[model samples]
Target: MAIVRFVLCLMVEILVLPVTILQYVGIWDSLYKRVFPHLMCRMTTTINDKMGKVKKELFDKLPEFASSSGLTILEVGCGSGANFQFYPWDCKVICTDPNPNFQRLLESSGAKNEHVKLEKFLVASGEDLSPVASASVDAVVCTLVLCTAENVDAVLKEILRVLKPGGAFFFIEHVAADKMTWLHFIQHVIQPAWRYFGDGCYLTRDTRASLEKANFSQLNVKNIVAPLTSLIKYQIVGYAVK
Candidate 1:
């Protein structure tokens, strides 16, 4: 059954490759922007809530200092402000994303999570956060974002650059499975088309390796199976301190 599904999906992808290429070249960005926020908000909220203990464990590692007024947090790719509900009261967040269309959704969600203040919204990508000062943010929080970055290393470097010394980067991301297995092969095979459809999310990204290469002061990464399909079940969760 899985093989049949894979073949069917591959056939569909082959047929749509040209149109997908057009979308990648910027044809359907507006459409994606308009639809993705709502879809993502619903999807992430449902899944994160379903994995309540896991979500709490990840957020619990955030330093208590994060709740202080002077401390600032940088949230990379804060799509529809999904993490707002998990933040501690009094934490000020600077939300950054390439899509300006998410501003309205973010604002609406921010209103509901009043304990965490929305400091600013920057129309920027993770690769270059020049508007954000070096070592200016107290901590960085990124969830399910690295795989979509054009250059994951550059994005991690920028996160490192913006974080104050002793600050931590708390993250949760879907990653490639370990070992050369059938699941790994499937992930590798469908990655290109999957990335196109998933808004540049690469299913085969070994994010744990990228995090290690970034060379944080201390790292504690754990692998877990998310409540997702086989294509994105594997995940890395934990914090890396600067």
Candidate 2:
């Protein structure tokens, strides 16, 4: 069944590849942001609420594994700057996203200025990050991001590279459903259409496997269900020291 789903996903990606390439390069940032986030919000809110709860747990749990004191933190795909308020007073958090409008919003929030030169802001993608320094960050945070990434493994290696030895990576992500037979079937069947609108989100990816395969030690994952679908599965909140 897993092989069948992977094959189906690959077929859809092949079909969508050309248009996706064009959209990635030709779509203007302003236009993309206007349509993209609004379209996704309505479809994604229920899962996002679950995401928020898991992120809150990470904020509280991070101090134990990746303390804020003298730490440099990085947030990938930081939409709306939602995680900013939860950060500790002493940490320097670098918020990054490829979306230009969202980057501008983060800049205007004064998260950049108030932290002075300490805080870094950049327009970067998870799979290809340029602003982050190797082995320099104390913690890397990603929430509900992998579903949209074109290459999840590359991003994980990037996360590992940027994290200092003994530093931790914190995350909360939605994964493939293990409980909802009907909804899962629908998700699998309509994935091609979903890919077009979702900008590449694959609900079928076993996010836990991807994370663990990245060599993140001490793997711990738990299933979590949101308001609508079991495919909104798992809220994973364990740290792997680099």
Candidate 3:
């Protein structure tokens, strides 16, 4: 029995679980449309762990980025509005995604901000966000959201275009598999299937270089090498001042 349970956990950890692991960890808008299997709602019913809360712990490390209030903010690739609760209350947040069902679910979740319902839940792509004005947004937060966005460069350009001159861009992304032998091997082997079923999420991408090349300067980056969570180990969590 113990061995069976261990095997079950291993299976879940191998990137195929009842729940789309990308949705739970990546929290990107496109996961529902691109990555998730039908009947994936069954997994959400069992999720007790809060990825957003765990992610919020790294926020205090970003005192400068947190000081803004009432600034217009955009959470590009906002998936299911899970990261919505972690952002500051005063800043107006606009969450965009391509999935209408997830958008309606987010709407029905009654996800509200202090000032208003997080404004403008739109059916949009990150590469081309037309509704938002350039140089008008004060901050952009991308949390584990880069891997699946159709064109990362276009999205980065959009981020640069929208951000105000001293605005902050905070992100927590799951990058490519690290140099570790076992994980890298698995990641390489699963890359094809992951692309097909995991919503175009690559197990490999230098997430930091994307931010750096966009003319944004990195503020902090932590490489978490914790066990059992090695798949997300190559993490880059920090804010860049534009």
CA shift at 231, candidate 1, in angstroms?
Answer: 1.3
Runs in model 1 deviating more than 4 A are 1-13, 65-69
Instruction: Between candidates 2 and 3, name the one with more favorable TM-score.
Output: 2
How do the residues 1-242 of candidate 1 rate in per-residue lDDT, one tens digit apiece?
56875786687688778867778788766577678777887888777776667768787666553534465889999999888877776778999999888899999989999988899999999999999999888889888899899999999999999988888899989998766577887786677567756877998888898899886989988999988888888989998988
Point out the higher-scoring one by lDDT: 2 or 3: 2
TM-score of each: 0.90, 0.76, 0.73
**Candidate 1: deviation at residue 102, Å?**
0.7
- What TM-score, to 2 decimals, does candidate 2 have? 0.76
lDDT of 3 by residue, 69-111 (tens): 5567787876666555555545567777766566665664434
How far residue 79's Cα lies from its native spot in candidate 2, in Å, is 1.9
Stretches of candidate 2 off by over 4 Å are 1-30, 37-52, 65-69, 108-118, 228-235
| Residue 53 displacement (Å), model 1 | 1.8
TM-score ranking, high to low: 1, 2, 3
Clashing pairs in 2: none
